[model samples]
Target: MKVIDLRSDTVTTPTEAMRKAMYDAEVGDDNAHEDPTVNHLEDLVCALLGKEAAILTASGTMSNLVAALAHTNRGDEVIMGSKAHMFWNEAGGVSTLGGVQVQLVPNDKGGRIDPADVEAAIRPDDVHAPRTSLVCLENTHNQCNGSVLTNEDMKAVADVAHAHGLPVHVDGARIFNAAVALEMPAHELCKDVDDVGFCLSKGLSAPVGSMLCGSADFIEEARRWRKIVGGSMRQAGVIAAAGVVAVETMIDRMVEDHAHARRLAEGLSHIPGINVDPDDFQTNIVFVGVDPNTGSTEEFTDRMKEEGVLTAYRGGGRFRLVTHREVGAEDIDTAVDRIAKVASEMRNAR
Candidate 1:
């Protein structure tokens, strides 16, 4: 049986075309800004995100950390959503390495942080509070069932931040997914923010790389910070070449992944012992809630693994299922059937 891996889109394999591009890539030292393929990929991200310049990083986490370091001085506060990936998942690099403070605003179920709350959270510079230097947001927010933040949603917060003399950075790891679901261009989606970063490895299906886009000065500073964090790569065009192919070809296919996710969520909602609402899923991630009568989320995940389906338990009786390019409609159907069977057995055991 073919294992249907629904843990995350980060597990996607690169396309054959991407492999060919990587193998045939022209190379030079990226640290010297001489890698032609990396230069091209940076230019593509700049154009795609409507930024004056861009820089390449090894991962989305590095990109976000670089952005934070570039935008804030030590001891300055960075405001963001409470459920943001940077805060919850980035190992506190900004706080630990950059000496920055994190101030969180509540994110709604749809992944929007209220502008009023953002404005209210900004410190008054009374010498007792840390100065608010930056605001961060996540598009297709990971913990929020892949919910998308509209440009207006971003702009509202941006306006508040800008008025307070603060810059905004968007952790756009799955930004293309947001653009596809919103039917908006990537440039338009990110225009309001001072900096935005996206992963080429996730929904785009590239083997590795993330791109950070911003103004020329900002990118220059971010590049310096990236080097400080040991993110500078020599002769990195091998992977950057695949990133070029990813930006050129893989963005449009995210719509299919989003559809598959919705199908899986809808099907899971119908299954016994699982609690899910199809309407809660907008992009490629579905959060499956286990009822009290059902088995533990970990137990269910292990049982699904035995049945040739892999999933992730995201704490609190919720299991996350993400759809990617590798898994198609048939795979989703098979996964749903097997999962429902497992749920039935678990309920019976209970």
Candidate 2:
């Protein structure tokens, strides 16, 4: 049986080119900031994001945590989307470790917080409330079918946050994917924001790593947080090498993954119990609502997995099918057919 893993883009395997680059990497004590390859990756991230400096981290979560810690002091506050991964997925490290208060604003269906809402969330400096120090946003929002936020859309939030002397941090884990969908430069999407972080592992097909980019002073501070969190890696150039190659070659190919996601969305939309708007399938994630009239979400997911179409069940009768370098459009089509047949048979038997 052919297995198509669409659980997430994180499931993607590194390309042969990426592997070759990793094999040839010159690794050293990155903990001391002396690893040449790691330095190069950071430089690449800075150049790509139009930032003054960058620091490589183990994962997007660590990058986000470091960015948050750097942006806010203990007892500070952050404004973010209620649906963002930082709020729902991450282990709440920002609050537990930094003693930062998270003020969440409701996210619209498009996976964006209104600028007006963000403005209202900022606290007044009366010594009564935790100072609002940061505003964070996610691109290709995982919880919302990988919605792409336009540069203007981001600027609106940035404008509101900056007006109150708050720094904006974009959790751009899938920044390249958003850039491709919007037909704009990835840097442009995040340039207006005060700080940004992006994952090299996802869509880029790198084995591991993410980078936090910002002003030189901010990166200096973030480095201290990196060490405190034990994220300071030694001889990490081997991983950074792959990230460099991912930035150089892997970005443009994400369009193919987007196509595959769209293909899967289209197929799911035709099924009676799977409610998905194929047109909203941007980037590489397809979100489908499973109707209980046919079968429970659990039953649908289990059946699909049994048929070798591996995916994840998002809550509220929603399921996520992500496209990646490891899987292609044909795989999407096959998974869709298998799912439709299983769903049809399951409903008939019921």
Judged by TM-score, which candidate is best? 1
Extract clashing residue pairs from model 1: none
Model 1 lDDT per residue over 1-350, tens place? 99999999999989999999999999999999999999999988889999999988999999999999999999899999999999999999999999999999999999999999998999997989898899999998999889999999999999998998889999999999999999999899888889899999998999999999999999999989999999999999999999999999999989999999999998888998999999999999999998878978888888999999998745798989999999999999999999999999999997
Kindly list the per-residue Cα lDDT of model 2 for residues 82-153, writing each as its tens digit. Answer: 999999888999999999989999998778899999998989988788899999999979897799988888
RMSD of 2: 1.0
lDDT of each: 0.94, 0.89
lDDT of 1: 0.94
Model 2 pairs whose backbones collide: none
Off by over 4 Å in 1: none
Count clashes in each candidate, considering only residues at least 3 apart in sequence or on different chains.
0, 0
Candidate with best lDDT: 1
Model 1: ten consecutive residues of lowest lDDT: 310-319
